[model samples]
Target: MQTSTIKLLRALVCMMLMNSLNAVADKVVTDSPVTDLSQFAYPVQDAKEAFKREQYAFVGIQLHDTLETPGVTAREVEVWSTQPVEPLNTRWQSFANIEEDRTALLRLRQYANRYNLMTLKLLKEKRRSDTMRYRY
Candidate 1:
């Protein structure tokens, strides 16, 4: 009777541990945000141009797609993250053209705000410059 009781207690303890581990696994699986890579279909060339211009916002969008795509080697994301950015002034020369690159530009603008990269004053200045350029 003593041996049977000890074995039962051991089995109960093991089951409890397994249940706790399963719960932890479920929490970990559910905690992360679900991102659908299919939603990020922006052209790679556009992303490259944006990155060359030091537009971190656009680059981040591209990074999102690149990071989420299956079979994309880890080395690719490492390269993207380590890519150098040009001087801020050189990169901030022009605002995104809304008509031509609407969605991509919109995503860039959204990320720029979220990351606090571009301030309201700077955005206004960019808009003013864009207007001045067209004034002839």
Candidate 2:
């Protein structure tokens, strides 16, 4: 009778742990914002043109799409700030002073510029490699 009670108690403890784990998983899924990239209008090619035109909002949207692409993380975006450090005195203060919308737009712009530059560098390297291959 005591052995049966011990088995039942172990089963109950296992059930409770399973339930707690499921609850935590559900919270994580619900907390993350679902972004539909298909709905966004601007493409990467248009991003540079949009920036040149000073259409910051469109540029921001393009950047957001780029940042959301696979292998990119929130930490990468967080590290890429638009503002220089010397002006703010502290990093947190720089981020804090801006309105949420403005801050988001700035972040997007910074990301877009970085993305464009990286793309250009890759293309140049690819071209150089192709030239070297053809010459040999």
The most accurate candidate by lDDT is: 2
What are the models' TM-scores? Answer: 0.29, 0.30
Task: State the weakest 10-residue window (summed lDDT) of model 1.
Answer: 85-94
Model 1: what TM-score? 0.29
Spell out the clash pairs found in candidate 2: none
lDDT for each residue of candidate 2 in 66-133, tens digit (9 for 90 to 100) = 32322223443334323211111122323332233343444444554554454344444655877899
- Please list the residue runs of candidate 2 whose C-alpha ends up more than 4 Å from where it truly belongs after superposition: 33-136
Per-residue CA lDDT of candidate 1, range 28-106, in tens?
4343132222333444544445545855331232331132222223443354344533211112233322224344445
lDDT of each: 0.41, 0.42
